[model samples]
Target chain A: MAIEVRIPTILRTYTDGAKAVEGNGATLDALFADLDARHPGIRARLVDAGELRRFVNVYLNDEDVRFLDGINTALGDNDNVTILPAVAGGSV
Target chain B: MKYDTPLEAVGNTPLVGLPRLSAAIPGNLGSDGHGAGAVRLWAKLEDRNPTGSIKDRPALHMIERAEADGRLTPGCTILEPTSGNTGISLAMAAKLKGYRMVCVMPENTSEERRELLRMWGAEVIPSPAAGGSNTAVRVAKELAAEHPDWVMLYQYGNPDNAGAHYATTGPEILADLPTVTHFVAGLGTTGTLMGVGRYLREKVPGVTIVAAEPRYDDLVYGLRNLDEGFVPELYDASVLSTRFSVGSADAVRGTRDLLQQEGIFAGVSTGAILHAALGVGRKAAKAGERADIVFVVADGGWKYLSTGIYTAATTEDAVEALQGQLWA
Candidate 1:
């Protein structure tokens, strides 16, 4: 199964400047491992000690993976993964 | 409802029903095709506030709370980091109370917001747009330090921001819809959800408080993602049942749906909130449970008209038109 992972601007360098890359894994952890195989050191930026980095937010199909199963969240075919750096949101 | 002054006319907005939109959802329709047991949607029309947005509730309350405690005295300058509504609300209050108002806002915010702030006699300071509101908040904090005399209400971390909703918005919703099963609002400073969520949780046996957060990098005007560096001090995860991340396209679609189906022309963030409300409503309907979902209409669309959202040819066009601009 092919899952599309969208990379943030800050981490575009690791993806060879590609905005999105394709990977396959049953779970997000395995997905990251697949991505790391293709893009070395990319996994390190997103994960630290098997936990998602504090400044990184990963969403699977617009749902926060943190609220789901975090890195262990199961991935399905046709799922879209988005990774973004934590920035201060809009001021209300 | 007649009030002594405009400031006194902050809350008590209309709670209108969205029968058409609610019935359009397949899940909301009963098995027998009747209205009973159908998931329903109610809008708390916060755009009806004096300053034309829900921020009036917190802005007025924060200033009043500060005044009551002697922190904000006459002639003091009130500083804040705002993309639009809060600054305009504060400026209106400051003008009436004989205090100077200053707002640190992102440069990418709609021109209407800048003009509104200036019209209300607030001094506007523009921050960089790279990191969005995060940059604005940092700049405001720096400015506050440089000008210690200026009292920054600091809505992101201020208790009064949420306290304002707890005291007024929360009670108003319950009084209007006692059977409200779900409460949804945009996630910004987290004041609305925390305040209203806590209030409903105490009174209602089982109430679901859902937060509608902007999708990361989607940039819906006034909403925020908690995972983002700055979690509003008022935010408590325990208070929320679940959070939905909405993208700009979905937000635009929801906004158009509200205007087209229900005639509620609200800000972009409200559209995101409605999307989340509908999501939860669908879940409850799928479970064959009755639900009374109430969502917030954060602000009016007047300020966002220049962004071409309401008049765009299509939802995609609307989303494109809103690029790099804070439509909420």
Candidate 2:
């Protein structure tokens, strides 16, 4: 099964400027692990050493994994994972 | 240990229940009978500070923390990064406390902010506008590394920024609206949300916390991707019950509506919170659910007078042009 991992614009530099990448796995952990193998520094940035970054969010098919089972959250075939780096900017 | 001026007491801002704003959304959008009286929303109006912005809270807290730890001394120079408010507030506070201040900021910040900072005697180092606050953060970090004696508050990573809210703003909210069901704020340095959100969650177990964020990848038009990424270290996404992105146009329109309907004049970020609050209110109402949406008015509208967000539009073309630059 192919899982699509979406890369946010800020982390594109770590992904060879790729917006989305395909991974072979039925589970999120497997998919992320495989993706991390391909991009050495990505897991560190997105997932930290073992825990996810406090500000980074991984949504599987538009549903947050945190509300589900976190790293164990199941991912179906053709599922899309979006990475969002939370920030806001404006005058005063 | 007596303070010289009363402005030093600016950190403890009040959090009041916004019956008007909350009723307008929940009462009108309620689906179930329970929604008529269940959720309570409070607004932690940071605009009440002397500088007309919440930045005064963190600005003063950071200075006090540094002074307590012997990291800063009287008459020493202060260095930090800001989009605008933090620098301006720090400029005012440092002037009052008798500290020399230098701030690294984006070049395209509003003239009002720049002039106010200058008026408070701050030396401004302009960063690349395209780089946004990240560049300012980077410059501040570099400056701190370069200077050994100068005190840099480092608001981006400084726990003191969030601590101020945790100690003062959060307690104020909990005290004013003990029944607060939801807390909403812009996820800026994450300090505001983290500080207040953490406090509210601890004080009120079932409190729903939400954050309004700009689209992390693109500009307001849903075009032009943003590559520069910056998230404050203090922000923990897990604490937020819901997070949504608000476009600049919607934020601007919300600010306009807030002034026209509620008589609450706030900054652009507050407009984002209001828009988010309305969305959350409607969702809860549509489901026959009741919830309170507490949002923060980060600052007053005095700094945005040049943008004309609160006035009548002379032309559609001119309004569109101004809208584009208002948040730019």
Candidate 3:
């Protein structure tokens, strides 16, 4: 079984327009490595210096990975990972 | 219960318990499986405010702070980017205090919000709906530059916005439910979370501050995903213990459940907040720990009635009906 990763509109270019791609790893770090193997250069946009990029947000099963273990957050077989650029949020 | 004016009656909303819904959660029963009141849910009914949403707290506070700081004065124009509630609250306050109100709102927000803003004597400028409130904020910023005299009490970054909750909402909650173990609220400008989170953290030991963020691309009105490129300046991630991305489907289900089971009619964002509240409650129940989780009922269902969420035959249908329109 593999983890499902949903890509955002801006990052879809890295996935060749594929909205979602599957990767296998026990932890998010390994999952990005697995994904980078198939989709080269995609990991750079999401991570820098072994940390999640400033504007990029990755969620595992709808929970923010930042509050988890960051890039080291564990991944389950059926986990859903979503990657999106940080945008201004809220009704300010 | 008595106030000098409607503007004076903004805060001190009721914090009511959700007994029926709390008991309905399966694992809420005690270890011996008899008592079902260990895990409880409470709603901070911010809908009871003057403008019918929690925004009233921040809107009034921001404006008042600006006034006290000499940024806002008599006959000054107040500019803000709002999905709805903040504009309405600001407009009402401005009208009463003799200030002009201009709101830059998303074009896709419900018509009810537009009419309400107009009724409150505020001019509305429509921002693009593609990027949601992000676009609105950008437009407001551009307009603020052009109108130098226009005081933009930017709620997203304003300290007083969060300060409102810290000074009032937090104290009221602690006073009403001193045992509150967790505080959950919809993640909008992050004012509610940051302010109340800080206040609760200072008093309540190990209080879990949970943010019920709308899932990216879910289009729940008045809520934004932090990853969407615009984290409100007021949003301090450290203040939040954890964040839950609630989708339209779950938000719809939560709204319907609150209405059906608890008879609490609230907007879609409240549904998302309640969903997170229940999530943490379930965790506490499973661990057999007593918890008092309080979530914000941001607003009433009156403005959202036109969206058909409350009357839809099923939650799926309600979610489907909410597409393309901002339901929160």
Candidate maximizing TM-score:
3
lDDT of 2 at B258: 76
Error of 3 at B143 (Å): 0.6
- Give lDDT tens digits, candidate 3, residues A1-92: 68999887676677898879999998999999999998899888788999998877888988899999999998888899987666555434
Q: For model 2 chain B, where is the 10-residue window of minimal lDDT?
A: B216-225
RMSD of each: 2.8, 5.9, 2.7
Top lDDT prediction, candidate number: 3
The better-scoring model by lDDT among 1 and 3 is: 3
Best by DockQ: 3
Once fitted onto the true fold, the runs of candidate 3 whose alpha carbons sit more than 4 angstroms away are B30-35, B216-228
Better of 1 and 3 by DockQ: 3
Measured against the true structure, the TM-scores of the candidates, in listed sequence, are 0.94, 0.76, 0.95
Q: What is the TM-score of chain A alone in each candidate?
A: 0.96, 0.84, 0.95
Compared with the true structure, what per-residue lDDT tens digits does model 2 show for residues B1-328? 3456767658566665555555666445433343334444556778888888888888888988899998888879999888789888889988988999999987756788889889999999997664566667788888988997888888867899889888988887777666667777876687887888888888898888877764332322221133335667676777788765665666777778777766777876788787878777766766766565678889987877777666747333324544433242
* Residue A75 lDDT, candidate 2, scale 0-100: 79
TM-score of 2: 0.76
